[model samples]
Target: MDKIRNFCIIAHIDHGKSTLADRLLEHTQTVADRDMQDQLLDSMDLERERGITIKSHAIQMNYRNGGDEYVLNLIDTPGHVDFSYEVSRSIAACEGALLIVDASQGIEAQTISNLYLAMENDLTIIPVLNKIDLPGASPEEVSDEIVDLLGVERDEIIRASGKTGQGVDDILDAIVKRIPAPKGDPEAPLQAMIFDSQYNPFRGVEVIFRVFNGTFKKGDAVKFVNTGRTYNADEIGILKLEQEPQKEIAAGNVGYLISGIKNAREVKVGDTITHVERPCEAVTGFEDVKPMVFAGIYPVDTTEYEELRASMEKLQLNDASLVWEPETSAALGFGFRCGFLGMLHLEIIQERLEREFDMTVITTVPSVQYKAVMTDESIKWVNAPSEMPEPNKCSHIEEPYIKAQIISKSDYIGPIISLCMDKRGILKNQVYLTTDRVELTFDLPLAEIVFDFFDKLKTISRGYASLDYELTGFRQSNMVKLDMMLNGEKVDALSAIVHRDKAYEWGKRLCEKLKELLPRQMFEIAVQASIGTKIIARETVKAMRKNVLAKCYGGDISRKRKLLEKQKKGKKRMRQVGNVEIPQEAFMAVLKLD
Candidate 1:
């Protein structure tokens, strides 16, 4: 136990966390020289392409410092605000954290959030200034910033370059000396906390856990404390980037337990595992995961309904945070209402469904949770835009608000402030990190940021801004459900909740945007956006006036005019063409906002 260390790396986006992990793996000889892969822990092509860690991964390494053999367990975590919950759970399972900061960019909002979480978990955070090999690196200035933020001593902060493999040995040395070994009694009854898990079609559920007491071996009858289901432990092992079978996993060691559960639904992360006969007290972990963003996902072809559900079940084994259930749409046929941690989470799942499961799905507009107050004095929460209550039926609607923290260059502060203000943001405070860098804090509605806010922020800040947000609470706002109609037929999927003040502007912009995307028909399509009975914005797609009189050779010009008049009259009668066959692309037009 004295020679064992459990630690994970935490950082902001693009801060070289994965690079540092590779350096450590190489330093400890965890992966062979030929077998060493870039971002080995990520194990997802999407993660590699996006340059982010979407899921937390656990691995074990054998290290030796001056003949002192030590076993190190490293958990790599995602740096985005959407995956903060996952980061927290990863931190909880560790005794220390490697807080990696980009030397050029310094500490951003996500770095601060991760620092707070590490502090909350009471983990020893060793400040490591990464990316020091960059040409623009400012190690001294970043070190000072770290001191100001975390209040640690000057010399204690480590300066390392994840790219150059510098200070990798020092990092491992610091871990052995600073991070305390796991303390648990091997004589006590079995009590294991399932930190994370992975699902395999052939091998079943492989859970990553840290044992607090007793021992677990292959063929042991283990029971999940919460679900009270007993399953035989088919295998036990440690992850050396690859699962290596172990003789036994005793107290104070981190490893994987292969429970004989076939589906991913059977595995529960943040749950306790104990021996069936020698059960001990269950270890408490995180509360049930609640998805913040909700959207409806339907198969492009109705024949793929069962395949979609089966794919979702298989995907959920890998991502249990993904919440989904059956849903029906009048225009879209049958589908499912899926919940996600954030927009990126929603996108990743949709991508996995298509790329891995080969299922093409149409996703509705992603919406934040809103609290609806009814006329009868009942309060309810809504997720999807379609679930929003009518303005006349609702007493008031409260939208979810978040405390946003933004770090950027001072030169771009003006535009950021303007963008935030336009989104109904209430400025809370501002501070200068350096002469050129600034940190601005605001309380902004989550609804506004759910769409194009991130993209807009990048455009305004020249990609120099980093944002992190947390739900502050619900706030009362002048909110309304903006409904868009196509030729008098309401497209339930196009409906959205917006503030009353900007309803007309949004409505006008959306109608104009849709006008460009929706194809023109024989009958003119009136795309109108309205709040209750009041029409706020409208656009007309003129009917294709076919030259019905083109074949009238050498007749009076009035004959051609009369033929056009007859065609116009026919269009008026055919205005309601059974909801107008809207293309699948038309339904996704809302995703292309101004």
Candidate 2:
């Protein structure tokens, strides 16, 4: 136990956490140079392409110096706010965390949030200043900021360049010296924390856990504390680049357990695994992850409903945070209403379903849960506009709000604040990080930012602004559900939540955008936006009339004129009763308004 060190690397996205992990992986010779890949901890291609970590990955390493040998268990976690749950689970598995801050960008919105998270977990945090090799690298300036933020001495902070392998040895030494060894009693009954899991087609459910006490052998029958279920361990092993089987995983060690259970629901992250014969009490566990964003996912072809369900179940095996249920939409055929941690999480699942499962899906506009106070003194929580109670039936509606922190240049503060104000954001505070860069904090509505806030914030700040947000609570507001109607038919997918004051402008703009996107029809199509009984804006799509005079002969001009008049009359009659076929893209036009 004294020779083991379990730790994780935490940082803001693009702040070089993965790069630092790469340098450390090579420094310890965990994997050889030929086999090593850049940002090796990011196992998914999507993660590398997006330049961010979406999932947490773990690896065990063996290091030797002089006469001392050490076991280091390193976990790399996603830095984005959407994956905060993953970060928490990663932190829980480790005794310490390495806080990596970029020398150029310094601390960011996510940096502060991650700092608080580390503090909450009571883990030893080693502050490391990374990317000293960059041209604009300012170690002194960023060092001062870290000192101010973390109250750590300048000398205590280690300076390293992940790209050049500088200070790699010093960091490894600090881990052995600073991070205390994992503490547990090998004689105690079995106890372990399941930090991560995966569904293996060949091996059943493989779970990554840290042994808190006792010993686990290959054939031990372990019981899950949360579910009260027992499974015979088919195999036990440790992960480096791949699984290496072991005779036993001792106390205070991190490894994998091949729980020979085909069903994913039998095990879960944050659940405790104990020996069935001599089980110990479960440790205080993590809080349940509540999804903040909701969306309706319907199959492009409804006949593939069962296939979609199976695909979702497979995905849920790995992503326990995902929650979904069978739902039927009047317009979208059969589908499921899925909940996600945030917008990024929702997008990732949608993309993976389409690409990995070979199923085409139509996702509705994302929504936030709103609390409604009914006229009968009752309260209800709604996730979709269709679930909202009638305006007359409610005394008031309360929408979810978020505490958003932004970091950007001072020159762009004016426009950034203006954008926030437009989104019904209340400025809470602002502080100068540097002479040029500033941090702005606001309390904004969750619905406001769920759609296009991040993209718009980037545009407003000229791609220099970064954002972090968390749901604060619900606040009473004058909210309305704006609906769009095409040819007197309500398109449920085009509904949105908006403040009443912006209803006219929002309605007018949506109608205009829809008019440009919807194809011309055989008859006139009326695109109208409304709130309850009031029509706020309307756009008329003229009938696409066929020329009645195209086949007319040179003679009998009067006959051709009569044919044109008849055609006009027929078009006018058809315009009154014919249905307009709006394409799928038209229903998604509101998403482009950003």
lDDT of model 1, residue 333: 88
Q: How many pairs of residues in model 1 come into backbone collision?
A: 0
Which residues of candidate 1, in runs, are more than 4 Å off?
A: 556-562, 569-573
Put down candidate 1 lDDT per residue, 458-503, tens digits, no spaces: 8999988999988888888888888888877788887888888988
Q: How close is candidate 1 to the true structure, as a TM-score?
A: 0.96
lDDT of 2 by residue, 388-438 (tens): 889889999999898999999899999999999999999999999879889
Query: For this target, which candidate reaches the highest lDDT against the unseen true structure?
Result: 2
Question: Every model's Cα RMSD, please?
Answer: 1.8, 2.0
- Model 1: weakest 10-residue lDDT segment is 576-585
